[model samples]
Target chain A: MNYRIVTNNPSVKEVYKDIIFVNGTFLDVLINVRDLVHKGHELISHPLGSSIRTMYSPYRSIIVRNKTNEINKDHIEVIENSIYSYKNTMQRRKPDAVNSKDYAMLDLNLLKSALDEFKSIYDY
Target chain B: MKLELGRIYIKDIQFGNKTHVNNGTLIVNSQELIDKLKEDERVKDVKVDIARPGEKVRIIPVKDVIEPRVKIEGKGHGFAGVTSKTEQLGEGKVNVLYGAAVVTVGDIVGFQEGVIDMWGEGAKWTPFSKTCNLVVDITPIEGLQPHNHEAAVRIAGLKAAEYLGEAGRNVEPEEVLTYEIGTHTEEEAKYPDLPKVAYVEMLISQGLLHDGYIYGVNSQNILPTLLHPNEELDNAVISGNCVAACDKITTYQHQNNSVILDLYAQHGKTINFMGVILTPELTTLEGKFRTCDYTVKLCKMLGVDGVIISEEGYGNPDSDLLMICKRLEKENIKTVLITDECSGWDGMSQPLADTAKEAVAVVSTGNVSHVVTLPPADKVVGNAAAIATLAGGWEGSLEADGTIKCELNAVIGATSEIGYHNCTVNLY
Candidate 1:
């Protein structure tokens, strides 16, 4: 359960000490996760974790295996496929919601669930 | 386990001096119910309103819808673990407010929350439109976290139902339906000739507003497990999911799961109903493989001839559904998947995130992305403008004439994966 949170939601910055905060859309967060996966960090949680409709929410937070090593093919496949599906589903529409904070909180809370398990496993 | 549900059909609802039921009408003391919900400090204010079958009222930003039931003979009341102490359900007599629903309406937490119109074209889509709805509009105290906001609305709906359910405790039901199922061994012995069929109910347990509850424990914390069908009907599993409005399994849906009921109907007649396997759709790929594999193993151990696997919400979970289906087919085990599609507005997009050659027998509840237009209602509850930000809705979805143009995803239960909706796909 070793993981690191990658998010654009400023809400998580105060909570998690380590996070790759990318100031971008939901797609931007997934792309950031992809960049991590390419650099040897495997994804611990699905990039599509909190939602299946990737383009629907304005914010997204992903958890990735923090330890870097040889490339994990499975992680790459998942992230690439996720990015493709996301781009396909969204049809180039920008991330949106009635209120940005509402979507941010939704993403933050879901990330917290995986963080709970990660904390227990990492024993921090 | 044997449970008898006494149904008292409610014909109407009215605000009265005291909360009670008379004849077929459900009378509520608004202040009393509001007071009960406000006891939770997270909830700042509560408003109780009535919307009947053909009213010109529209309830927007709807959260959870719960059925009101009073346990006259059960060990514990319904909504165990949350509204009441942890207790075993599914083995007692409970009185139900058959045609009434407690609908919670409030701030839209995300791209979730939906609309429930009482009449016109909009009414045809949501099953809640047919019930005598006791709309509970809750406003959380300012500065409440989004997670707590969801909880406040969720608990208020459950509490309102609990308080209203008390009125039915004394009223004699019009019909008493009994659901009795013995142990798998006992049933197998008696109905050895029938095809052994079991139900695999895949619940959303990703995270945050994306999880279901088993006796109030987050589904995210549990592995795939087995449950007597009665446990679901009697409130062993509950919905805290705030995903897509069209397909998310509401707490009400768990209480009146159509798949469980349909399986029970054919039990011993067409098939020997073994039991239900509750599988959690997790967020990790590893978790998905583990749950999917473990689920099929349970079905194999039961020696089930066939299984009806129903999914909650779409997308990543679609992969989980197919993984289990693929493995079951590999074992020569029969599986019929029940799900909704996310096909584009043109109905030309791929039906699911993943598919298997073994997924031959699949029942489509409806397409979540299908577009629909709902004419405005005379009276609107909650916020009408909330639809613009909903998953299936856009910034200009709410028009000048109060008309709304959006996908079926914004309409609650329009595409229920559990088969409790009005959606159908006719073969061309």
Candidate 2:
């Protein structure tokens, strides 16, 4: 089963033209992937039926493959490190990329912090 | 001259859209009213308030009247814009242009109120009109004189010489005169076969040959020589304190302080003394006379028959240059000015050129011996040496390297041609 990812951000469109889903994992199938991620975007998911369960936990972490009930800190750190390295590379490639106003996918910590702040503002 | 007062009469007048009158009964002596009437082209004639009762009306030409007008143009702008997350939106933009017009007092132009209109996307509205007036009057002035050719040539020559002198070279008179009362024995001994006019012309031309009078050195250093010619003269038999006396003999047999005097004596000519040295090399200003005073002292010391100085690049030389010319005039020293590198401030060059021209005119009119200027270097078309040659009024190749390469043709071109016109191309 396969899914796709798309973003409306012009900066994202400029870099990541498309995304690909292979097996159970999603991969950014785009040229200049770093630039697309650095510009930012809203993350949305589409899943193949019965193959995976997608759940956004209270901690703002996106869960996939229900068989792994426990969250692995090392795996989360690897993803975070990869995102940070991609952003750094994008910055070096195009200094003006950061100045662009664009939506982008949020990592667990950033997503959690933003959701927390929103909840506090709403007194929820 | 007869006292002729100009007459004025209104040519035409128009009062709003009601009436266009060739002749009107609104009699008045006000120049302001006359100017306004003149502006109205519809008015063919205006009545002037004469002292006499019935014949108070007088007709005047509109062209003869003078008028003034003012026109202005201005613009202002206001703008706003917004965007929402629900949908994509394009930013808004705005721009405006406006101006004003003025009619001359007596111009007789059509009067109309100007209107401004504003209309655009996401913009506000405002409409308005501006009314302006024009004025006119009458003025009579004098005309100028016709151009003088010989005077122009003399001025050009004087300017050229002055430029060269300022650049630091010893220059000579543009013209020379000689009175020969020699014995027949001397003529027979020298060249009895030569024609009198020919010989005299040759001698005078050589003696009068005045070109390249630039002070190669600064004038201040040359001052000591001027003040003490006798002490500086060594084995120079014909050396004299007076420049004129030294001009009688040719050949300097000495190498003392009076090198300039000896050079003049040997050459039977005058040497231009620049009075003070001023160059990038001498960083200090202590030894230099004020530029103006130095010019005057140089003219006096060198027994300047004719003096030329540039008014370009230098500041107000009027008082100093004029005073020197006056002083020289009293002692019968001719003075003229050349201008280059005009100072845009005060229109100094044009005025100085005018004054130099006037000076030449006065001397020529008085039948006094005048100083002529040399043709200037064609800076655009020639090398440095060629330019210097032109500046010095000398015939030679003045190369960019500052070398004065003389040819036989150049030497023979002018028999009395002196080497002082030679340009030194300082390679360093």
Candidate 3:
């Protein structure tokens, strides 16, 4: 029933303690996290380059999220401009029911808020 | 193979000077029937009781229910492997005591035995309530182990059914229903345009209290194999299971399998009923994977377009159900699964322990954990206090006033996975 940190993010270690940490890049954590989950271990995926995928287990629950909001301040203007341009292009075309929203321009705060709520419910 | 089933409807049963069917009434010579069952050395004593459709009676700790059938023609008679000598069944002239069943009760084997109410609200949930039940209460010799006790009761029920079936040997049947499935090539040629469909029936074979028998052979020892659908109707398979009463497939269900009958009803005109595949539900992961792989392999070998899968027990078997469905869909074979859910008492828990995206079409039987209250019957057949330890019951399930408050798990065939009953689950 151990919930291990499967990332090298310094922020994760600061928040959690006494858990096995997988000191590796975010890509490494993504590739081997499923195996850990299969063994009844929960993984807290690094927020970098990840997507929201919640998998439930009786012993533990894995919370996966991307940390795009942690991007360097120098690239903020570029990322903002690219997101606005994509949103404007998507709005000009007819909206399909399944893809009505421009996911590329999603609000990053939503991810943080969701993570906090999941943590409060899952941290037992 | 073809089978001609002669139905002799029985309306009432009572003890008499001799055993015979007269004017829709079954007259049983109680002394003769008792003597026949006492022949088994393991049986210490035998007592017989009759429970009619509307009687205020309750039979508890029920082990198995069997329909009486006598084979008039063909290679073998009665239950192929257990009650009768070993032979390939399915093609024969058989007479069925259509409206009567032999209900066996005795010492408890596992916490999985059930209760059958003859009348009132509780009677509606169990199919055995509607039949004229010849309740057989068996007592084994001193120090008899659980294994032998189960076998003794199982064989006694079959023997009694076989003995009663002899009465219809010379009498004319009220109606005759014939079932036939031609050779593989002949059937394929007859229904060339219709889709070919197969049935996968999972049996509990966990040994000890949990097991099933095919032609008297322990099913846990075999791989997936093909069986003629008609053979099952003639007692090719028997139940040795002691799982939850609600979902376990009894010998009666195996003889009158609704899924096979439903599929056979649509054969030729709408679909080509290929055959049935019998697979065992093992305990270990490797055993499960091996059997499941063999099941899909057999289905592929048959080259069927669609298949219907039915599960016997719950929990661990749910994984096997999903695994088989996932493999079958990956091979492009359309599949529909029949299973009972384990939703909690509030009906808020997940229906199954496992799920697969490929299992899109499913027939959900009622939840096993749903609670029900039953008023006391005027007469209790077996040990009434045994309900306290039943799988779906707790320590205080039985009330002082004789009314019982327990989950559907304590009732036999309440959530039959073979679609034997009308109970189903719907989201509110």
Candidate 4:
């Protein structure tokens, strides 16, 4: 899928338009792109002029991090592992066969891990 | 402002020859109600039914629930602006048909209408399950849009409540409750030592099917404003939004607002109850900033020491709640927030769209996306199949049998943000 970031910061948008080598989930890319824009890097709106060009899942989750507090590589690995496990579990289930409500509860263990890092950081 | 409520407890409801209150029972002439609602050309037909507590009945796609009330004295009548003339309310001798409610149900207005189960496990989730409900199912004219259909159904419910409230006028009440609140200066002089607390209510005003009306005006079209708690208790504000049912503030909850009542209970003793501030949750970013800033400014202007902010819908409106809280805490004003969550069925998602450290003290009114299964009812009022398209429900939610499997969002008042019900969320 083609993922593009449209930002209010014109300088960031101008510099990031030509850059391409991206491989990540739509939510993952949005969070990283938003962080980049917040860092004062030059930015501009996408050519399509959409905040989100394309996304795999309609249910989008945006995780906002506190830039003042840095997270180590180990913490990133834990979160990534959790995401992978959650995705794998979801893929194994037949989404068309079950309703969204029922689908949400298919793998509570995986869901908990997927949200562990966010919950720890936010103190929820 | 001072108001007197004469409560006539209705132990049962029956369809009989006449519409009146007798021996703790409310008798209604269903045909009369149908004729009254049919007067509106926008509505094609009206069906009235009854669902009593502990009955094997299910009411789906419920829109609004209203308590019946009649103004016997004072300035204005019950539902002053809409059902009656636009007059001052809350300082009147009103008669209430306590333990009874006017519940509106019909075709899907939006993907947010809920279900009401009168018995079994589902009964514990919603307050309306305990009331003697006079369900009014209205069908709009052919080709009517959802927005217009919502308006027609809302008016029909209010009209039905006003009609039923009339039955209590001549009959003597079993109990009477009085409420009186003085002006700001009067309260300050009377309770100089008590902490002054105010209530800020946020209304959903996204547009067409999602909106709240105050005195017949859409709240989104106006700025943050002040209101006496009495005005709300007297039905000055009406809920017209089609937000997810669990969190939606129905018209009944507005009249018997739990927060206002509890605060009133502690008025002269624990705290000096200040007036209420009604704020709107707009859809646009600019509108949100404008409204949130104006709300905090009003709180500061009120010179309140503590405030309780209650949110209406979830998702985008969560930002407005935090924004208001951030500003209020900056002004050193103590605050407590009441809201429901959409933390997914597993309760693993974030409870809110935005978060602020200043929002330390909060009340969680259960999770809207929590999954539940309801047994089949012996009899179902309105279309049970309507659950499939509900916000908290999805395709195949209604089984071949009468059983229903859906999210709490499809249940009416399951997670009332006003603290009307006792449901809450606790981390395991």
Top lDDT model? 1
Q: What does each candidate score in C-alpha RMSD?
A: 2.5, 39.6, 15.6, 9.6
TM-score of the A-chain for all models? 0.85, 0.26, 0.36, 0.28
Clashing pairs in 4: A10-A43, A11-A42, A11-A43, A12-A42, A12-A43, A12-A44, A13-A43, A13-A44, A14-A43, A14-A44
Between candidates 2 and 3, the one scoring higher on lDDT is: 3
Computed on alpha carbons, the lDDT of every model, listed in order, comes to 0.82, 0.21, 0.72, 0.72
Task: Look at candidate 1 and give me any clashing residue pairs.
Answer: none
Highest DockQ model number? 1
Enumerate the candidates' DockQ scores in order: 0.41, 0.00, 0.02, 0.04
Per-residue lDDT tens digits for candidate 2, residues A28-78, read 322222223333321121110000000110011221211223454433432
lDDT of 4 by residue, B280-353 (tens): 87654455677889988888888899999999876557767888999899999999999987666787776665
Cα-based RMSD of candidate 1: 2.5
Candidates sorted by DockQ, best first = 1, 4, 3, 2
Q: Which ten residues in a row have the lowest lDDT in candidate 3 chain B?
A: B387-396
Superior by DockQ: candidate 1 or candidate 4: 1
lDDT of 3 at B367: 82
Please give the range of 10 consecutive residues that has the lowest summed lDDT in model 1 chain B.
Answer: B387-396
Q: Report the lDDT tens digits of candidate 3 across residue range A1-124.
A: 2234444344444555533455653334344444444444332322221101000000111233223334333223222322232232222222222211212112122223324434444556
**Model 2 misplacement above 4 A:** A1-124, B1-304, B310-314, B341-358, B361-428
Angstrom error of the Cα, residue B400, model 4: value is 6.0
Candidate 3, residue B372: CA error in Å? Answer: 0.9
> Poorest 10 consecutive residues of model 4 chain A by lDDT?
A46-55
Report the CAPRI category for model 3.
Answer: incorrect
TM-score, candidate number 1: 0.93
Q: Give the range where candidate 4 chain B is weakest over 10 consecutive residues by summed lDDT.
A: B387-396
